[model samples]
Target: MSSFPQIPQTIADEQQLDDWLTTPSSELIEFVRTLSGDLLVLGAGGKMGPSLAVRAKRAIDAAGSPASVIAVSRFSDTTSRQWLDDRGVVTHAADLLDRNAVEAIPDAANVLYMVGTKFGTSQNPAFTWAINTVASSQVMQRFAGSRFVALSTGNVYPFVPVASGGATEDGPIGPVGEYANAALGRERVFQYFSTCNGTPVTLMRLNYAVDLRYGVLTDIGLRVFSGEPVDLRNGYLNCIWQGDANDAIIRALGTAESPHCLLNLTGQETLSVRAIANEFARLLERPVQFTGEETESALLSNSAKCCDLLGAPQISTETMIRWTADWLRQKGRLLNKPTHFEVRDGKF
Candidate 1:
């Protein structure tokens, strides 16, 4: 693997953070050299997509490849579209649900499927299912021959004992809530098409990906910094730095298989909400408050297979905690999107 940029003691501003997040590692640049054609990122307007798309563009450029990075999304947030356009990534405004629009997308040898709805599942279950399942079917059919790395959620697996080190890829799946079931349906659709069309795919089951802006860490840090009582009901979780997650997802393109490879993408350690909040209290020099008790089980995933395959994430959990604490102390910009990870009822 190529050497990564040195981890900063503190990320000074959004510009610095974005630059860090989009910096492609040497391994990624090397992978892009072997990639055949342009890279298409569907649903590129979401929280993680812009950075991922930009990172791919950087990697391709660093590799001196002619492949272009194309991003497709509804782009309800015009700023996201503008951000991609400014970064030398090709931006396309389209609704994944519209079969005609999906068909109109430019062809690519590699596709990263990031389209799915999760936050408003309780209020609009049908829409969640449509975005997760229907949109997946449309994209799978439209790009039947492309090597795909589809984003999936760890929620597809039922909550396992914290001591179990999370659910493995081969374990039985028992999604608890409506959103999770729909997420599973999305995976099934990918599998079905992959079986029929022999499309190579890798389904990445990711839990919380912390970006210092919005993530499990930011959620907990905000609560601690604001003197709000931290909820510990759904105690433990698995998370990866958004940049590391993006790196793994991009690299996994090579591991795509006709049968559809299933890999859990996350940090190795099972993190504790209580411990994290207490650390935040110390960092912020504030008293910690808490409510509820830690549960024996939480939604988690074991990424041993992914680590063995892609090499372990370059960022460490300790570094994420320190960086998150500093970001909160500086009153950094937040997406204001709460992870709601404490909800155990399967509701978003």
Candidate 2:
């Protein structure tokens, strides 16, 4: 057993997903193609989980064979599971804090470690560390043979000076501050796991994966659509569409490189909040309004590593906003449920 750790899956529509599969970037398809044998997707029931699972199923099926895809989650969303099963995906449930569940996962060559906590998750810092930091290490220990890819946030970077371009991977990340506990503790936990076990861990430092649920799109789009004013900060927002994000994760599989890798998951362009809002308004065919107030910090990060190492490409910002806004028009809401990680600072 590695350690104690941790599904609701709801499928929106099969045809909708089918159309999404045809998307130009094909990020998800590319990622899963490199994976073979058993595939285990952590946090498989979450927002990105279902889409990623389906893409994996497609990748495995097209090659004229069967591959076991275990989608792990604590809460099993029957609808989501059924969707995956219809497309040929298996389901597993466990707590990451539990050593037994981690060990119980069928041995696989790839482990997509998507499990994580949020900005103000659990008032108890202990719970955050236990789940985000400690349990993550145990997972790496348990799946040493597997090429591991886990989602990290841009919040790990320290304050950068204004007028600087987006950060490259080489820039020093300051301690996690102004949010929950220090990011140093969380960062160290993963750093230790990667260094000690030689797990081939790829830490993906994602800026903002554009989603209807409280991401870059929802953060600025809603106010624009509702004819409300927005407060602009000097911070630049680097966003990637969630579908592209799902694809990027799959690409991390089969990365048979020496030493652990760190890649920034972000859009190629770093635009200000006001700039994004203006673009969103243009897409929605509405007039843009904004009050410019430069917030001290910018969350810009570079995606050169992903593009260079894995050919992970980003969707254009205008396209991302259009997709999100269209979905909102159809669904009449940003998220079916509230997201806990919703950011108020407009920093990504």
Candidate 3:
């Protein structure tokens, strides 16, 4: 495996962060070289979408492909749209929930479906279902012939024993909460379309994608730094670097199937949140607080299949923890988005 690249301790601004996140690996470039046709990334304004879109552009350029990376999103923030626009990624602003707007998007051979809602599911599950299931139905109908990679959540899997090495791709999906159930419904929608229309689709079950700005590591690091007690109920969890996740998503485009395929994507190890908190305490030179006892089972994923097929993640968890610590110490800009990984009931 290639050595993990060194992450700078202090990122000066968002552009620098974008550069770091979008820097393409040789493997990613090689993967893109095997592809032809422009790429369309739907719901490209989310946390992972911006960097993923930029990565696609960089990879296509590196592969010397004429494929343009077009990112379509509601684009509530013009800054994100401008960021993609400036980086050679075509940006389109549209409410994908609108059937007319969905029909208006230019068809592309390769499509990345990144739209879904998890937070506020309890208070507004109708909206969640609309975005996760209804919108996806329309999207599938609109792009029935295009190869698609849809981002699903690991929460769809029931809590499993910590020693089970996480849930495998073939594991039974027994989601515990409305959010997860709605996510499963989203998957079923695509599966239905894939089966009926012979549309090639790959469902990417991603748990957590970490960067310094906002993620499980950053969540714990901030809590430890603030001397707030870290909850240990959902002690064991998994995460992968956002960049590595992006690589896997793009690579999975090649694996899309008519009946749909499923791949669990996350880091290999089952991490202890308490242990991670202690590590962050050591890094921050602060005392750590603890609350709630560790549970035997937590939401986890087995990504061995993803590793075997799409290559192992390049960034190690230890490296990510250290980078996150350094980022927090240097007062790096955070997107203020929390993972809510600590929640045991899956309320968020």
Give each model a TM-score: 0.99, 0.83, 0.97
State, as a TM-score between 0 and 1, how close model 1 is to the true structure.
0.99
Candidate maximizing lDDT: 1
Better of 1 and 3 by TM-score: 1
Backbone atom clashes (below 3 Å) for every candidate: 0, 26, 0
Candidate 1: regions farther than 4 A off = none
Q: Which stretches in model 2 have alpha-carbon errors above 4 Å?
A: 1-34, 178-187, 212-214, 256-258, 285-292, 312-314, 331-333, 336-348
* Candidate 1 lDDT over residue span 217-263, tens digit each: 99998999998999999999999999999999999999999999999
lDDT of each: 0.93, 0.65, 0.90
* lDDT, model 1, position 20: 89
Error at 336, model 3, angstroms: 1.4
**Candidate 3 lDDT tens digits, 1-348:** 112357565555666777878988787788889887889999899999999999999989988999999999999989889989998999988898899999999879999999999888999989998999989999999999899999999999999999999999898998878899999999999999999999999999999999889999999999998889999988989999898898889889988998999999899999999999999999999999999999899999999998988888888899889888888888888888999998978788
User: What is the TM-score (0 to 1) of candidate 3?
Assistant: 0.97
Worst 10 residues of 3 by lDDT: 1-10
Of 2 and 3, which scores higher on TM-score?
3
lDDT of 2 at 177: 39
